[model samples]
Target: MYKATMKIFSGTDTGIPNYSCKTSGPLAAIIEGLPTELSSQFSSLSRMYHYPQISYMSGNLFMSDTVKFPYFYRTVPSELHLCTGIIKLLKFFSWTWVSIIAADDDSSMRAVQILKDGIEQNGGCIQFIKTFSHSRTIPLEDMVNLYIKTSSANVIILYADKRYTGAIKYMNVLQIPQKVWIITAEWDFLSHYSLGFDDKNNTLTFLKTKKNIPSFYKFVREVNPALFPNDSLTDLWWKDLCTNQCPESIRRSCGSNEISPYFMHCDTIHLGNIYSVYNSVYALAHALHNVVISDSANTTMWSGESQKFLDFLPWKLHHYLKNLHFTNALGEEMRFDENGDLSIGYDIINTVFLPDGTQRNEIVGSFNPYAPLGQDFTINEKAIVWDSEFTQIPPKSKCSPSCLPGFRKLTREREPLCCYDCIPCPEGEVSNQTDMDTCMKCPEDQWPNQKRDACIPKVVIFLSYEEPLGIALTLIYILLFLINAVILGIFIIYQHTPIVKANNRSLSYILLISLMLCFLCSLIFIGRPGKVTCLFRQTVFGITFSISLASVLAKTVTVVIAFHATKPGNKLRKWMDSRFSYFIVLSCSFLQAVFCLFWLFTAPPFPFHNMQSETGTILIECNEGSLIAFYCVLGYLGFLAGISFIVAFLARNLPDSFNEAKYITFSMLVFCSVWVSFIPTYLSTRGKYTVAVETFAILASSAGLLGCMFFPKCYIILLRPDRNIKKFLTKNSK
Candidate 1:
């Protein structure tokens, strides 16, 4: 250690008057090679003199501690970022089921816990983690074949130094022929290697990003003893001597791996990681320039006095190295991070072994931990070539298959989250994407499609005049209306006849007009239910039917009064006037009109969309704002019909000639039966059929009243006019 230190620096030499000491001893140390056991020793020794020691290769994980090695820096990134890059790479290919085979050495063992936590945290399963003994060939072969060769894990992450070729020397993953391996640059196959056919295929390597150092390849190819006979590197490769034993005038050319060191000529060689050492020289040069260069013409570093030469002091050189930044010949930024490491990432190489024993490292992807989230890791999967040992291209390494759309993932018991089963989505819900845990529900007015992956709009429907049901009901209502009109005409033409004069003739005319209005009210229920129609339809039905029933009650009362007044000395004669019967009709009809007005002003019906009443359709119907008010209106009409029926039935056997009480009773019975059944039928029906039922009730009851009360009178006036005189009337009145 002391001899090496003396060759690197002269601690006591300050170059006061002697210029030969200017370029000697430790201004700074450029430590090269991989991170090894000696790096810590060198780092500790370098820190004693306070010299800045910088390395270009990613080194020991423990070297990153500032307290232990504060002056240590590297151009390559730390080993911690390599673990992160491996995690991102595994996720990119969905290789969730994998194995970790590392060397039983400090460098590989340091990353075991980090890799375990990363793999498990991301829903991945680790079949096993084994540290193979590279020192014992027998144990190494058994452990590799026992745990990895027979296991189901297809992808193996091999972590070790490139110099240690233990388990992966033959790609012996659990002895599995179809295994894929992802090895680090420390196990670099980019250099010279003689492997079994198909051994390099299905293998990937994380190589440090490299740029062509100008003239580096040319210098390696053209290097000879004539160019630099004093340098040890050129002297070892080139020899131009004729030995006395073999007469070396018979020229000999030698390859890199030849056993004999003596050679007349040299072949080209691969320069691995030489670029990093070249960058190391540039780092030292830039640090010295800051201390040497001057902005002013007369203030150059050479012109400074001895006191200003303090910049060359060991500790003083560290300040410039700590904050050094520059661009290299390839236009790549070169700088050290706060932890004294370059923040460079890795390039993914798809190692391809050709048929003729040649090899190639195809750069198919990159992993940059310092990059933004989505752009950090990327791979061109199609560019990867598979090994002949595998039966498929881009081999699968998953615990379970993916769940298809319209299905949800159901995790298996006592298994990792990656192992799961797929279950179909429930009714009225959908899963539009694969691997969803929960399903979504459609809106109120929509329904799920057949695949349950989408929602479709519902069909909107109403009671329209264009449908078959509406057409038939329309023709029936209009025909009944015409029949009523024909009866009213017959009554007008037979105004002077005795049959027409019976049963309170004016009450008959009022009842006929109101019945016509009831028929027209049914038309309101047949068309598309709108705000104006829905508001007034039920009210109109209530008022018009009330008047018709009220007129019937008046006729029954008038017949009873006419009979009672015929008794001698009966006081009912005063109450038997036609005005008294008109008063009863007016008072009963007015009460119904008042109730209808109260209902309209309080809680009126309105058009509503009944979505729940049907599936995949919207039923446009009237919504009774208040159920109590709706029932009250029907009850009032029922009350009038009930009273009218009782009064007419009691007076059915009164003077048959002038009494139309029996016919009035039958009409009231029909009207009462039609509306009483309408309540349950209308409530139970759905869609446009409900409106049809109510319209049918209106037309049926109005036709009953018109046919029963007026059709017989037309028959008597037209078919038997001989009995129309007062003498015939007196005979019929008995």
Candidate 2:
């Protein structure tokens, strides 16, 4: 917070607000008071004389705290805002790994801490932060030179005030080329001084936003020692800037040789806090004017209370100053908040040093902390003056580059967060954006693309009849069905023959039909599985195969009974009839039907999309809802086939007329072999291939039963007519 004083003298600027203005009349006053810079001495004087001490230079934000220094009002915004804005500016340029060197003072240290925290909080990493005193430390310069030569960070924040900036000139600082310095408006005076470096075009100064004061430039330039000779300070300032051949009016250009190198610096027109100075003086003037007018309205002409006594009343002017609101010549509304800080933002200016050792300040950007996030800091990259050697490319200052898509950042163990490695996303997961912390999982119906940066719908697959495997299986099932039909027809035409009637011909008819149905059921498993199809495929295969096994069991039992009853008038003769055979077949098939009904009611199969089974594919296959129910159906068929195989094996060496029992034994062996292999093959396979395994088991077992049992009967009935007769059978029976 700087306090600019309005002195009685007609000068360009002064430091204290001791002067007051008045009208020509006895009781009339126009502008009585104006304020300027505030010091400890000025603070005491302002309170003693009821003055509002407005600061335009001290630049200490906490000094505006109403309780600490009640009379003080600051024009410079908080340095905390400047720190916040600098962090934003660094992030905008992706400068995370920068160094910070601050002055060893209260305000500079505080600003540095805020800036450090801001950098880290916004994914920025600080390479190093060191403080230097006005009493220059040898290590500060050595470390600066070392870091400039060794460090990758091209940006460095010099958090110092004017005193430290002036101190920089005296130090034998080594060349710091290729570095971009971030300093405050106080350092803008560096144009008048040098830090022993030729390359300083990359400096960015955070200046308190100031507007042009109309003819302030003309006044500063034209009014040389000739006009302000009485003011020795103004005379001295004019002689340093002007040659012995000084111009009366700068409207006429001076010779470049006659002018000082400082001419270019002055022509740069770098204005710091002049607007703050103007407002501070104007605020004091307005308060004094109001006090004079109010006293006039009371019809009192400097009566009772002396003007000196009235100046002692601090609260009178304090109230007006706190409530003070006015528009300046620049059309900007200026006001003081409760804390006594002016409502103004900062301007980011780039200092481009020319070949003549003079500088140019370009307003490249602006920062307003009061604005919303993402809208607060703005920069014009095209307007900034970068190092010409780098071909105008923006400097890079980061510990690590950003992690691209399809990869996640892995923080190094003993380093900063910005120094991290990028690793590919885990299997089945994806990272769609750059610098993502974690990978995401795709849905069941979707999968990550090859790059892992995006998700696409999973390929829905099933054993469709149009596919190559499905077409092959369909052709095989159809050809087997036709073979089964021809065999059934051959048996039907030769029903009266002895070979067909050898062991219950009705049982053969029932078994063939059941085997045909089993073949048809296996084909249903090949199509795209719907709710109805998935429900029926397993149950129907179980029921039809059970019926065929039951028929073979009945034939084997009858052969055993018929051979035993003929031996010694045994009781097995009473059980040898078509009614008992039909009852055996129906009873065994009914048990399988009961199991199917319970399975359907409890947990029937349904269509499901199996994603995890195969990458990037959704197996649109049947889900056998109950594993126990599925095994029970398969196990029941095995039990029936086992019973027939054992029964027929014991009676395989019976009379020649009962030759059908041996066929039943061999057919049961083939049936049992197919399903035993099916379980392991089915369990091991995935997706639609598992369904293909189960369907194959059904077709293979059904064909095994048909070929083993009926192939011999068909050959003897058609090819050998003599063996088809009752006489040939009776001869074999004897």
Candidate 3:
């Protein structure tokens, strides 16, 4: 406790000899690494708490990144936070260009680095050519000469030790009138040399040795006269104590004759250091007291326990000092950071010299106490007369050019920045720089460029027979039909014997041709729409049904003929000739062909209406034409089914081998089953795949006839002697 009091009252050793000893100019507080002034004032009202009462600076001023001391909080926010404030100040001054003047000394150099870093970080420029620095070895005159020769800057920052007074003197000698604005570290406040004040006109006539300290003092006096108040706490305490008794015998020395007039001089003013020292002591005492009391509630207290108390005392003291409303002797708030540096308030005092050699000061502005006044802006960029002040322009950034139709940005700097290189969109894909990660694509109907860099128009519907998929299906169906026709011709030419002929081989030929036509007809309905498609599609469908129906009728008539021919003396027998059945089938086929021709002439096919996919692509289809054909096929299948059922009933009485009608019956059933499904399937399917479904139906029926009926008969002829044509005829003839 005694040690702390000694540190404050013990003068020169703690630095700032003038403020401590009171042998020179007005007292000044030099704060470092903590709250300067305003932060402390705000803290004074924010908090209150109990803490240890001790006589030493017992709390830590050092801070962690996230939290600081409670009682011993900083007035300066932080280095980075201060930089942000500095940037804002620089931008306010509109200083686009400036030069830095840093001292060779470590502390001054650190402050210079901080300012320079802040300037660069804020997108401001600094001209290295105009920067100045003074080495410790350099004399003041030489430094000034170097500064004058290097640049014409109107503003000069002094980042140096208290010895900078020599440099200030030399600068004044170089320029008699104070044309340049000078800014220095707080150390300049301790200078004792006269600033060449002329008391006659109450003005400063030339550059002064004291620089701007006296001006700052005078301004402080005008703003707050209590700063230099007449009453003194120390003097009052001394007088009261001396009168109260003061160890009776010692009171004799305190008499009027023993007391010098110098004793009363102390009553007039209080030194700035007195308040800082007293506050430091009281804060230390308050922290220790709180710790001791807090620890006493939970554990024992001793010198050994003091270390544990030190750990928590800073926080407890912070809670107490945050509401630092205590009045100090200096008439200014006394606050310190965790590092025990004083936090004080200061203002920019713009001083001008008059003819009478006295200086006049006016409050030009307020600034961050931890930062230099003009460090933010260059001298020329600053608003000298207030009206010509900087009109700040907001930062503007323009967006980059969008990707071209085939090209996309590979990597973008930002939304507004140009990408390094444009890449082509890949095939069947597209992209717009949605983010740095990936690009966006167009919908399905749209197709991307070769590189897939961007989207372009895509062909969604088949407009003509020349279209690729339609053309391919057409050529394939045509080639198949031609092969079928050739096979049917071979069957008619080579198998001409009576039984083969009598079975109505020509009708079989016509059936095969009709089936071929049925399969080929699907090509017309493969794609969405075309010019001739709508007009001819329905007529073609009708013909397909008619032809297929005639083939079924031919088989029915042939079946009836063979059955009637089995009975002698029947009236149906004579008319049941194979040639007659052939003629009837030909007539029926011709009649259907004519019906299809008539339909084509009267009511032509037309494009289907109301076709769309989930992806929003419109499809042109054959609607009425398709439905008409669909129903016709169903009707023909129904008719065939009726005939087959009736024939099977009648033939049930005949021998199984002689009739061989079960195979024919099964074939009819398959035909009916397949085509019956065609109607619903055709009506349900959309556009092109609908045609494939109908084609599938026809192929199924054809496969059933070829495999189930003809296959067995052919197997018997090829594999068995009993069913062999030559063997059967030879045995019967014998």
What C-alpha RMSD separates each model from the true structure?
A: 6.6, 5.0, 20.0
Give the number of the best model, judged by TM-score. Answer: 2
Q: Write the per-residue lDDT of candidate 3 for residues 1-734, one digit (tens) a residue.
A: 22332233334445431233534421111122222232333223222221212211111112312133233333322333333444454556444344455445444455567667776665444443222333332444565557544543322344333344444554553242222323442333221222332221111111111112223333322343234545665334334323422324222224453343333222112212333334555555554455456667888768776556654554555455544444344454455444433343233444444456444444444444444655532222231232112132221111223356456556445421222356665544566443222455666556555655556655455433667655765676676567566656555654653323434666666666766766566666665666587665545654554555555555665666666666767777777656776675666556555656655665555664432432334355555544454455346546655675567545544432434355567777787788777778876876556656765665566656544444554445445535545434223221
Which residue runs does candidate 1 get wrong by more than 4 Å? 1-24, 36-51, 59-69, 83-165, 174-186, 190-201, 224-271, 291-314, 355-357, 371-375, 386-399, 493-500, 569-585, 653-659, 684-689, 699-734
Q: Candidates' TM-scores?
A: 0.78, 0.87, 0.36
Ranking by lDDT: 2, 1, 3
| Model 2 segments more than 4 A misplaced | 1-51, 166-178, 189-201, 221-231, 240-269, 294-299, 303-309, 353-359, 371-375, 718-722, 727-734
- Model 2 residue 490 CA deviation in Å: 2.6
> Which prediction has more favorable lDDT, 2 or 3?
2
Candidate 2 lDDT, 253-356, residue by residue in tens:
44554345443233223454567778777776776667657656775545555655454445666777788787777887877877777777788988777788
Off by over 4 Å in 3: 1-458, 461-490, 525-529, 533-538, 578-603, 607-611, 614-620, 625-630, 641-653, 656-660, 706-734
lDDT of candidate model 2 versus the reference:
0.75
Instruction: Provide the overall lDDT of each model, using Cα atoms, as 2-decimal numbers.
Output: 0.74, 0.75, 0.45
Which model scores highest in lDDT?
2
Worst 10 residues of 3 by lDDT: 202-211
Model 1, position 157: C-alpha lDDT score: 90
